[model samples]
Target: MSKVGAADPAAVLKSFSSHLIAQLESRPVKDDAERAAAIAVAKARTESTVGVLLSAAEVKALVAASTAIGVTVRQDFGTRVTDADFAACTALLESRALDATLALANTKAGLSALRGVVAKQGAVKAKLDELTAVPVDDALRARLWRVLEAEPFDARATVAFVMHELGGADVMREWMGTKESTSLGTHTEQVIERYAKERAFHDVKAPPGVRLEPMLRWMLTLHDIGKPAAVEHGDRNMQHAFTTPVLVELSKKLGFSEREIGLMRAVVDNDAIGETLHWNVNRDLDDAAKELRALAKEVGMAPGEFFELQSLFFVSDAASYRFLLERIFTTDERGALTLKNEKFEQLRARVAGE
Candidate 1:
């Protein structure tokens, strides 16, 4: 085959990415017509089927290039698709395509390119964790994502907040063995459940009497902190494993307590459980239960305690469950996402409101 197609996807991507970014930088699209013509010419120069698999750093570099031209990739980068071949990345042509990708949202191959617009790192002007939510859900979705995109939180404070609230003495005592957990703890492909029996959970609430909003907020911000390292390892999915040690060292340097440190380790270690299930969409009840139980054992928790604490990571780990209905395969396999547990539904709805 050609040198660019299969032989060197990264090189091919770099060449095309430079061209795309350069077009906007040079002439600059001052209106819709120019925007359409520029990207279309760029798209036509390469075969529609011609695309590249990117290393995490490469993808980030592409994103940076895209951003320099004022392309709003925050929505694209902020969102994760289970199986996104990154079809959207291949072409940055239309306006609506920039809106939330359709059936793509439901598929494992789902990854997004851009959304409405970009604003530096984005602003959390309102308490978007609550979805500020006066507008329709789609509008709210974009707005809330901007909330997650804000990357200016105090690294130490965020770590400390997480350790102080979720990582406790009890959690510490429970943090024995502590085997490393994979991003999608169960490594098959897809979380095989037609309908999730576990009432779509979202751990968005602050604890009983404490001001734990920051912890919850950080859950949104910090879950994927190790992505840069994960990408360096050439697998974006491995961020969870990398995040554990990365944060542990950061916490230690920040002077957190050992109790907090140990529990912090546990919390970050298993943060990928939700997304693992999200990206992979198998519905074998027996298989899922087995995976869940196995994960608990790996982390030295009785299955009960594991389930209880998983909520902490579900929010931090990934928002896959919160937005489950948007997934194409999820709806296809399960008809519609469901849960017998009213409590879980209530919790998820309060935060997600989707």
Candidate 2:
């Protein structure tokens, strides 16, 4: 039964929610090709749901597979354009050059080149197919590449498009793989470890479980998928921190559960460790407020901030972050890590403590 007496009329009506729903509905639903890509990811990730929250590698593989299959399909069904056709077309344009016009020849050449490129199995072939997938004429498609090649845009559409083909989550992960450690990763891991410590400190004897590790790991990996578009392709270092529209779309598309997405966004929104803790305390006014406040002070923040920070700390996976850190940074004699050495010690201590 619906709560009749005191429900907010706005909650019931949800004008903004309805509008968002409608906007989402208006978009083209993922076709079989996209769905198959998504399903392939789901299978690889062992996710129960049927969707496209694949890693960048998985998306790349899927795109390659799909493009290869698409090429075969087109080859089987469509007439193969020959070099003779292109020559004849070009000849039409030149009154005496070849008896074919350049325009017609260019068209024939473009079509044939497209087929050839699509049929070939390689990086360039995949990129060309992706580029051609856009709804535009052959001339404009060719022009797009020329413009991109001549002067790369600050936000290189080719990179973005290729990355998009790779899929958002997968691309972001790949981007992260290339960078040394992301500051966001540092801040996130620190926050989680701190929270884990605090939680242990409060309980004093409890083990670290109850859905924290997987949750946090997922959060750190996913918090920045939308950053690229948000920062408009700024330095690779800074993109992870920006809150782009792509993040939201990715959150919706990826197989992450709703709670996971919420928690992931919570970390992204409160990305800064200090700010996150401050928010935590402010949000809660319970008996542990004193403890949280004290903890916040230790971390160099107010009590309120400490509580808010706790939620963020445990919001994602400390263990996974630690693993990545360990994997990325080999330990030395003192068990001290090499790269991001200072940050590593901080995290090491936090993990060691609990």
Candidate 3:
């Protein structure tokens, strides 16, 4: 028998199918043939082959079971389960169960529950704990990548992945906060989506060797990772820029190499430079150009590459600012960074060297 309270994927699937069949049978179908046809139709609609009519209570129960194992069900699931719903729930459970099981397997409470099963299998508790402690499942990684790719701009999804997959949601929550105005998580998501849209519009490409999309997503996602620590220390003057070193170190624990971590750090640091240049656009053009060149060197980017990076970061960051989004980028043209203010116009001219 399986360990008590352990999430058995097969059992879960069986239970769901049973509940669905029961619900379908209770419905007003004239005959077994009619019922089978109805079930077939429901199954066709769902990505899951076993799809059938489900009651509201059944849907809720399925969702609760999935959630217990750390799977997030975003869809309503309705009174009937679709193929898409089944597939989504199944995938979620499959991925989340591995991590949850591994986490549970490493704990004392988990061991106590598993004592009977382990004794039957002649497994040593210490060895089992050691095996499960690492918790590095490739399937989980793949699922998270899919989530990021599909919902590139979703802050909640991003946070959920980092917290559940990477094991640090509480810390991330402190950094992100609840309000949009002060939330680092909100700002990061806005920057990533805006940057992505701008890059595609302008045909801006990433540096030759870098995988641009994933790199940008990872960089922007963790750019403000150090904010909570800064705030905790009462360092009101702390900018996310000043926390690059900390971020770089923390990222190492997340499996980033030195080179990758270095690139991320440079991007985070340069974001501050972009912010400064953005604010000082109406100042001397020559001075701005000089600073831009210096900033480029500091980040080890060529002049042209730096310009592209800065423009992407500046525009994206600006778009996140409520004041700037409303007052400065006022045009209705999609993907156009039109400036309504004279200062912004001057800044644009300087950046363009016009």
Candidate 2 lDDT over residue span 1-354, tens digit each: 111111332222221111111111112333656435433432343312111123334334433443332211000101224564444334435644544454666777899889965553253333324322334345644543443344222223333332453333234433343334544334334434443333423222111231334444434444555443333344544443344233443434433355445444544544333222233432222323333444444334333333333433433333235554454444456543334324323332332332
Error of 1 at 263 (Å): 3.0
Q: TM-scores, in order shown?
A: 0.30, 0.26, 0.49
Q: Which residues of candidate 1, in runs, are more than 4 Å off? A: 1-221, 271-302, 315-317, 320-325, 328-354
Name model 3 segments beyond 4 Å from true: 1-144, 149-155, 175-182, 253-260, 271-288, 298-300, 332-334, 340-354
* Number of the top-ranking candidate, with lDDT as the measure: 3
lDDT (10s digit) by residue, model 1, range 1-354: 122222332333335532222233433434665445445544554433313334454556654555443342211231233233245453432233543354445433432333322331132222121211222334533433343234443333333333343332122122112132323212101121211222234223322342233323433334444444455556656555555544455444433445444544555554333433444542343444455566555545555555545554442223243344343222224343333323443333322223
Q: Model-by-model lDDT, in order?
A: 0.38, 0.36, 0.53
Report the lDDT tens digits of candidate 3 across residue range 1-354. 111122542234344442233223233334556445444543443333333444554555644544443342222244565665556445554565655444545665767878865563322233223212335566865665676567435656766666677655554656443234456655666776676666655544554565556666677777666566556646633545335654565455545556556656665665433334355544555565666667656555565566666666667767777777776665546746755555534444454456
Q: Give the clash count for model 1.
A: 19
All candidates in order of lDDT, best leading: 3, 1, 2
Name the top TM-score candidate: 3
Candidate 1 vs candidate 3, TM-score winner: 3
lDDT of 2: 0.36
